[model samples]
Target: MSSQNADVVLVHGAWADGSGWAKVIAPLAAEGFSVTAAPLPLTSFADDVAALERALERKTGPVVLVGHAYAGAVIAAVRSEKVKALVYVAALAPDEGETVADVFYRGEPHPQAPKLEPDSHGLIYLPPDAFPTAFAQNAKADALAVLAASQRPISPASITVPVGRPLWKDRPAWYLIAEEDRMIRVDNQRYMATRMKAEQRSIPADHMPMVTSPAAIVDIIRDAAAAI
Candidate 1:
């Protein structure tokens, strides 16, 4: 498919900003496709969806909305006709009436996730110790340190708000399972992929595949874009 036919929008997960997609953006853009790395507020589900919707409105042609981790929940909430397909990258593909927290705690607890505490505003922030193992397990120490220092505080409300609609149920979906993920277990990802009826690919990477396996992730998005 021609580059003009598809616009790839990358949505970041919680505890992260748009820079989370920095490693993968160039390669996808190098393929001659228009791309946008959406910087989500990570505040509330509704706010994040609204932010994504605003970004979607900027695209001139059909879009492939790619969500990573918590942003998967965000993308699922924003069901835009302009979005031709949905791609989940080690993302939380929650079902209707489900929330990200529900999916995470339903399964066994992740050892790496630090004990999260809500602030006066009810926003949850990942403690520094959890960053290395939970988020950037494959990244260099220096890079991981930078990420940990800059981690965004997630609004607690996003975890409890049930998804109104799941885009994967209607839109063609693609899922990339990070086999070595420590935060979201591989089994959970597999279950979600199956439930979404998504075309699946597995990579032996950590939670952040876009950082460690950008080419593979980009290829999946490309295939999904072509199929759509």
Candidate 2:
């Protein structure tokens, strides 16, 4: 598929909305590629997948779906045949029967993720103190504060639910590894990338590479777009 015929849909992770892709959107748009940042409901796997499929249905041509953190699971659940490629940005790339929580707490202890306690309504919100170090370690002070303030609580049930099908199994994939990511370890990222047989690129950044290194992230996305 030609770059002109490809739509790049960016998917944001937990505790964040689609606005998190603000830095990368204009650059991709400038490259003459139509881009849409899918605003995930973060309530459940089904809702998130439905929202992404709705976005995919709007696209007129081939798609390059980029998922960051928890959004990877959402993208995997989408059945849209329009998706021609997948880009994982420090994201959770789960397998056929894997869940986000299962992938995260699979082996070793995650020292970075605090023990989150959900509210009576089953919403899991990160504490204020964990934001600067875990979510946006590479971001500037002002940006980190904004991210923390804008953080939305995710549904606890979304974590353990398994994905029915993973697009990475069929679609070409590229993994952008953030070496300094505290939220998701570098080892786990490598494991997922290897599992997906993705083309890997390492960048010295934190969890939110689109914020800290938007240019680099755009370049990777451009390469993925070119591949399509």
Candidate 3:
């Protein structure tokens, strides 16, 4: 299938920006697939969704919208007609009337998962140590440093708002479950994948599989695009 007219739009999770999709962009582009990462303000649920909608507007033709962590919620809220498929990489998927917190705190917390309390500014940041242990346990030291330094603070309001019907319900979907993830419980990923009835792949990886297991991410996205 010719991917010339199809674009893959990547959305990052909390504590990260478009840079989170940096490793996957070149390879997808090299494969003749146009790829770009969306920049989200992460100020609130509405703000993030608006940012994603703006990014979707920039891309022409069909789009394979992929979200990681909190961005899963962003992609799900979008009603864009250009999107051909939805891809979740260890991402959160909230249903209608449900908040991100409702699904996130569903199952037993991972042992390494840290308790989060928002700062005085009402934004939440993953602690410096949380990145190495809970976020990307197996990532290289240098990569960890960069991830830690570039962490973005997610507004608490963003996670509390209720979501509408997820985009996954209306479009074909694929999911990648990080088996070794400490941020979102592995069981939760399985439950979500099953709930969405997504084409799912479970791999032994940390939370930030795009950094630790980029190939896996690329292949799943490739498959999702080709199928689309």
Candidate 4:
């Protein structure tokens, strides 16, 4: 399908919601791509996949599914035929039988990366300071404020589960590596991208490039959409 004819779905990772993709949405839409940010419940892996599938069901044409950070695994779990391509932005791509944690912790984390732990309710939250310090270290103070304020706690069940065969194995995939990412180390991003055999684009942005480097993210997604 032509770029304009295909649909684009943006999925946010843990500690984030659809609004995290605000900068990305407009430019893609302006390029004539019908774009929607799919919201994950952050409750469980299965719930996130089901939620993404529901979003796919509502789309009218081929889709370029884009995922950031933790949502990478969520997007890969969907078995949708409408997903014509996969675009991972500093995202994970765990192989069959591997858990998200396996890949996320494959390499050393940036020193400033937060120490995450589940709260009494069993939900893992990104420490507020982590937003400015690691998650989006390159983002401005205003952007950091929005991210911290809108952050959603992710359930432990979301990352601990083993994933089946990933959709990236069957579909064309592109990876955008966040070189300065503190949350997911740059080497981990390279490793995952290489393992998935994805076309890689390196950006000198932090973990949250959709906020700090939207133009680069938009360009890569546009490339993926056009290729499809």
Over 4 Å off in model 4, which ranges?
1-3
Worst 10 residues of 4 by lDDT: 1-10
Write candidate 2's Cα lDDT for 1-228 as tens digits. Answer: 325768899999888877789999988887788899988888888888888999999998889999999988888788888999999999898887878998876566457766777888889988887877677777888888888888888897778887776888889999999988878888999999999999999999888998898888898888988887
TM-score for all models, in order of appearance: 0.95, 0.95, 0.98, 0.98
- RMSD in Å for candidate 3, one decimal? 1.4
Report the C-alpha displacement of residue 108, candidate 1, in angstroms: 0.5
Runs off by more than 4 Å, candidate 1: none
lDDT of 1 by residue, 61-92 (tens): 89999999998888888868998899999999
Q: Each candidate: what lDDT?
A: 0.86, 0.86, 0.91, 0.92
Using lDDT, rank the candidates from best to worst: 4, 3, 2, 1
Over the stretch 189-208, how does candidate 4's per-residue lDDT look in tens digits?
99999999999999899999
Query: Candidate 3: lDDT over CA atoms?
Result: 0.91
Q: RMSD for each model, in Å, please?
A: 1.7, 1.8, 1.4, 1.4
Which regions of candidate 2 fall more than 4 Å away from where they truly are?
1-3
